[model samples]
Target: MQFHIPAGVGEGMQLTVSGKGNTLGRHGGINCDLLVVIQEEKHPELERDGNDPIYNLNISIPDAILSNTTEIPTAEGRAKIK
Candidate 1:
């Protein structure tokens, strides 16, 4: 699956991922993992010391899946079944 992230995510912004899928009328949802990184501005003094500043981030999916009681097709009904 592909995700479209919103723009203007700089410095401090809460990032979230959510989506849903259906199989035989049953709905399911998933929370994806994400990683955020921030870069620090360059400094001449830091360069002399051979030190580079960079931020590392780790994020986990809050929810792996969600189940629904309704029956739903795996594929879209409007399109012909492959």
Candidate 2:
């Protein structure tokens, strides 16, 4: 089965689907609701803060001294920060 995760869902959040879990009996007993816990996969370039993705910009000493735009990885794509 497939389920969609809504936008801005945070880590450790729980979602329930009605009557999707184990059933009580064979004779028309009610099925338990399915509970899903949300877990965010670690991204190499980003960390999560609440539902927002954060990227710490770290520039080399030469780049910082030269005042050049440094390209860094962001959640959406590569970004340049001076």
- Tens-place lDDT per residue, model 2, 1-82, is 8877799887789999888999989998999999999887789878888767787776789988999987878777888778
What's model 2's TM-score? 0.67
In model 2, which residue pairs have backbone atoms overlapping below 3 Å? none
Stretches of candidate 2 above 4 Å error?
59-70, 76-82
In model 1, the runs with Cα more than 4 Å from the true position are 19-82
| Clash totals, every prediction | 5, 0
RMSD of each: 26.5, 3.0
- Return the TM-score for each candidate structure: 0.21, 0.67
lDDT of 1 by residue, 24-63 (tens): 3336444344543434344332221223233322333432
Best by TM-score: 2
